[model samples]
Target: MQDYDETTAFLGQWGRFQQVVFFVLVASNIPNGSGVFSVVFIADIPRHHCLLPDVNITEDWLHVIIPVEVIDGEEKRSSCSRYRLDVVRNLSAQGFLPGRDVNLTELQQEGCVDGWSYSKDIYQSTIVSEFDLVCSEQWKQTFTSTVFFLGVLVGSLISGQLSDRFGRKPVFFATLVVQTVFAFVQIFSSSWAVFCVLLFVVGLGQISNYVSSFVLGSEILTGHVRVLYSSMGVCLGFAVGYMTLPLLAFYFRDWKSLLLAVSLPGLVYLPLWWVIPESPRWLLTQGRVEEAESIVRKAAKWNKVQAPQVIFKDYSAHVDEKKTPSIERHSVFSLLRTKTLRSLTLILCLVWFTLSTGYYALSLNTSRLHANPYLSCFISAAIEVPAYITSWLALRYIPRRVSTICVLLTGGVSLFFIQLVPQSIPSLSVALEMLGKFGITSGTSLMYAYTAELYPTVIRNTATGACCMVSRVGSCIAPFLLELSTFSKFLPYIILGTMSAVSAAAALFLPESFGRPYPQTIEEMCQGRRLKFPCLPPKQRSKLSSRELFESKL
Candidate 1:
């Protein structure tokens, strides 16, 4: 790394401009807080309506029962008598109930009920019934969810490679344009197939928003400030998305309108092309040291400091010789051989997996709660804002490993309690769910910061991307896992909690990097074995030094 005084001069107020653009870009990606669209499309539930028989209810229990169908021999079977009390009440208000005991003839004459029994001998053989929805088909709904994640998976895997080849600024601009076009097209989609295609393209572009913002933020800030700013940006964006989604859903009941609300804000950032700077670190890596220096000087100038004479330093020699040639050529396989790197990759992957599973699983299951889905989602999301802030405070005072372990352990503990909490006590269940949200959110924010810190500069982006790919494995499994069993409600939490605890234990095996400068090369990272420094007394350093001194004297 280049050796220069800490006090470097800055140029014109480009830093402020960069920060503003960063904030806007980050905020625009907050997945519509109204979450109605996501629930309608991604969660695969649409046109949920059911009829109740012989039940009197109030308005408070609306939306209590969702209709479902079972398959019988060569026919579909359905039932409304299976409706929960809450569902009965909801349908009663909506005119989905029978005033007295009515057979199929009475229901058919009234024109309120549809479908026929397949078996003529109702008592002799099992009769079949099928529930119908007024909205889209189930297969179509599943396709939309699949396409959304596939977009995320592909976009994430491609971002690092694309950003490295083309500059971060270009990638940012291109993806923004692509996302805007696709998002708008989604508004006009006539079928689920068309919508999925549009959403996939939208997903591809959205990844650019995140990767570019993170790269820009890291380049502009220094040391712990880098971690703090990036984590806070993400957390704040999520919190805003969560808080706003409910209101957006309430106002714009139509899914298309909600998509428009989320997509339109992103267009405002396209004009930021003039302001956002290319990554200076990336510039230096590509051997454009002079250009890197110019960018750095501009940043310094903006901070009201004078730019010092810039010197370029090559720290590449310190990297393990074996890993160097392959990495320099951008070989993905090289990351597997380096033990330290491999360990870092595994730990990061586990962290991401746990976070995504816990976060999305809870989000998808909000429909199971008695309270308003919008309100519950909002509260769960609102809890994360404070979690991120608290994580920032803890990172400042505590050692990196300790904070990571604590947060993971906390999430694990909360998840375990979720299994024990009776569903009958809705209030307590919601509270515990919120607590789990807090722990997982805090752990996730910290993981992003910690993963960036652990990787060497040579393959930082690649390593982070690779770990994210593993996390997608968890994301892909999450929906299926959630659907496996009726008793599987707490399964995601259990799996996430256990994985987080395992990651926390693995963190103990990594070096403590607090107060120490970041290691720039693989060699520097691997030079010493990791140990518990926070638990060690300060006098231990003095004792070791004195012992060496006495040995030299002897």
Candidate 2:
């Protein structure tokens, strides 16, 4: 059968039709960026202490009712506990001063009976402040994010199949509505429970919209433009959205306003349902040949080219000829049937899990670092823009295996140095953390393309889905891992650094997939034959050593 690329060549690569689809579809990813990282601001916990109500006592005396506790070797008032207010009031009436004549620690203490008072220096309000999710309720803050990712995990497993069963355009637009509506409703959440439930629904929509758009763009565009739209275009849009979050959060300090600021932009996508067409490839799979032909003709018209009637006729005839005996749909079990595939699958799983954990651990923990939270988040998001750009350049010039390994190792090395940096030099520590983020982001971006190149087309979606599901397991654990900093400041970094290092080492065992044509079957992959670079001269290829030869091949 002739490839779709051959029949669709008349559509014109990078022409008007492809450009419109590319930019329109890529805009969908920007809101997904907000869904993924917005939790950093929404659930932020500012400095807080116990609230002491007036009991005919002076202001300074009431302030002294909250006992000071040693935190990181510095004295700060306890957040959850305060001295008995009645006793303190009596002492104040007798003109007894706290710590001067009265032994404050020896006095009776209890939980914050009058509730807590949060410092509004950085954040004007957050879920933490609004819902009193501090002290004994602090774990609720982290759990909110975990619940959102749990929804993402569920969505990733089903969205691909749904898009295939239905249509990309419908599923994409449907999920966009779900995301926009839920995000808007969340702004008026009556309680934390309502907010969390809304967040989960929004997460379901977020991942679904992103995946559907990705599939649609890949199926509609032609040649390198298709590849670039998948990687650089959407990836940069996501980064731009992520960077936009901090700026929005900075201006709209209230959690509700911030939520509204991020959500309302999704409404701009409402009109795209009419503008973007369904994937012609997906239509062919469902045997809707006439509809696919109509789209192809439209694309040709937009590109200012003539649609050859013979091309569509021949394509439809070819697809019809193999309708009964086409390749059977492969299951997840098929991936594990062969030894090489099973081993490769396991290695990829580890790489996915470890990379995801380390990536999110750093991402979610940004607010905890000693700096302006908004500035830190902006820096964190801004750094990824260049990282994705560098990843694109590396994929073109460097071997996939080499680039993946180097980037992972760079992240691991940065994590190892993070714990070693002293508290006195917080600026240096922040720089190393940003460096680690850059490395992890680049590796993650490359891994998406590398995994696609490693698998055969028959089981590619199944394999990708399984690996993505496993990766979400890491994200589910990431917030909890970050919560462990309360126990030991170095623990999260140490764990992240260790996992990244091991994954980097394991990457060496995988085969190079740089310039090689993607294997179309399981047997072809097992053969492990590295193809020669089409552009390289035979003399140069022959002069290289075994390792250099592998790199030269792509």
Candidate 3:
């Protein structure tokens, strides 16, 4: 059979058709980026304190009613406890001051029985404020994000196989619709339980199309074009989406309004379903050469190039099953069918899990930065633009393995030393935080192209999806890791830093693919480890193609 890109070479690498497909797929990722990070604002926790129902304690006596405690080395009013209302009212009637006239420590304390009063300075309403997810229920806030990532985990498992089994275009649009619809439904959710359910489904769609887009772009574009699309193009789109999030949160302080704003962008992407065609490479893999040829012809026309009379070699007439290993049933299990592929898969899982966990953990921890959270979030997102650009340059000019190690180690080291920076210099803390973000963003962004190149085309999506599946485990853990700051303030940084360092070391084992051709079949994976196939090029086959055309029967 004809090589996938070789057959479609008439379309011209980096032509108008490829460019259009690249931009549209990248643009479609905007909402996915925003939706994933929206949790930062949606679950925001503002200043809050206990509320008393019946007797008027007077606003002047608000401090007296709420007991003060030393927390994080600062004397602040208790968020969950308040002096007993009866005792406070009696003290006020006696014209007694809290500490000066009466011993405050001896006062009885009670939980926020009447409900808590949340400050609206940072947010008018959030899931945390509206659902009262504070004190005992505070864990629910992080759990909500965990549930979303859990959905992403489940979605990653199926999205790749679904894209590989079905066409990339259909699966991408289908999941995009899933994300858009559920995001709308989540706006009107009355309770936190219902909200979490909708978020789980939204999470499913958020990353599904992202995976599809990655595979689709990688297949459609060739050479440096593929590298650009996979690395900076898609990642920068995500950064753009993320930057908009803080602006949306700043404008619409209510969580529902922000969801509505982010979800609206997906409607524009629906038209992209028709604009971008199914991947021609994917079409050829299923033995639908005629359909693949038609798409290639149209692409050639769009690029203003002449179409070849016969786009593909008549593989059905020539392919011999006895001469080639069977890849017809290459499911997720194919990744582990051989020892080399298995080792590649496992190490990739570790690299992906570690890097992605740090990436998202750092992303989620934007709120923890000392500056205005909105500003901190925007800066975090903004830094990714340059980071991805730098990544793109590195992918083009630098070796993939070298770039991977450098970025991961840089991010890890930066984050690891954040604790050493004194609180006296908040600027230094923010700078280290941004440096850590930059390093992780650049590293994780490069991983898209590196990992995609390591796996063969037949199971590319499946391989990527499988890696993403384990990586989502890290994504799920990120929020809780960020929450570790509540204990030691620097605990999350230490863990994330350590993980990034580990991933950098693990990346040492992965083979480089800086100037390699996309692997056609499982046997052709990794140039050094080609199995049962010639190093130069091997004939691609289809067991059903020689019997009958897959399209004609359908």
Q: Arrange candidates by lDDT, descending.
A: 3, 2, 1
The number of the candidate with the highest lDDT is: 3
- For candidate 1, write residues 1-554 as lDDT tens digits: 23221322133323564566457556654652332135432232332233444456744333323223453223322333333454345456676544432122223212124322222221111101122222333444434555666676677667756776566778767877877778877778665566768888777676655665666566555655565665676657757866777666556545566667766766676777777778766654454556766777666665656565643333222222222222243434545654555665666677778776776666666655544556665676678789989788776778777988888788778877888877578688678877877887887777766666665544556556666656656665666566653566677667767877787787777667666544444443443325222221345333433212211111
Off by over 4 Å in 2: 312-315, 319-334, 456-459, 516-554
- Where does candidate 2 have its weakest 10-residue lDDT segment? 545-554
Task: Tell me the spans in candidate 3 whose CA falls farther than 4 Å from its real position.
Answer: 58-60, 94-97, 316-327, 526-554
TM-score of 1: 0.75
Ranking by TM-score: 3, 2, 1
Per-residue alpha-carbon lDDT of model 2 for 278-331, expressed as tens digits? Answer: 987666555567898899888888889999876556545645675333334456
Q: What is the TM-score of each candidate against the true structure?
A: 0.75, 0.89, 0.93
Candidate with the greatest TM-score versus the true structure:
3
Q: What lDDT score belongs to each candidate, Candidate 1 first?
A: 0.58, 0.78, 0.82
TM-score head-to-head 1 vs 2, winner: 2
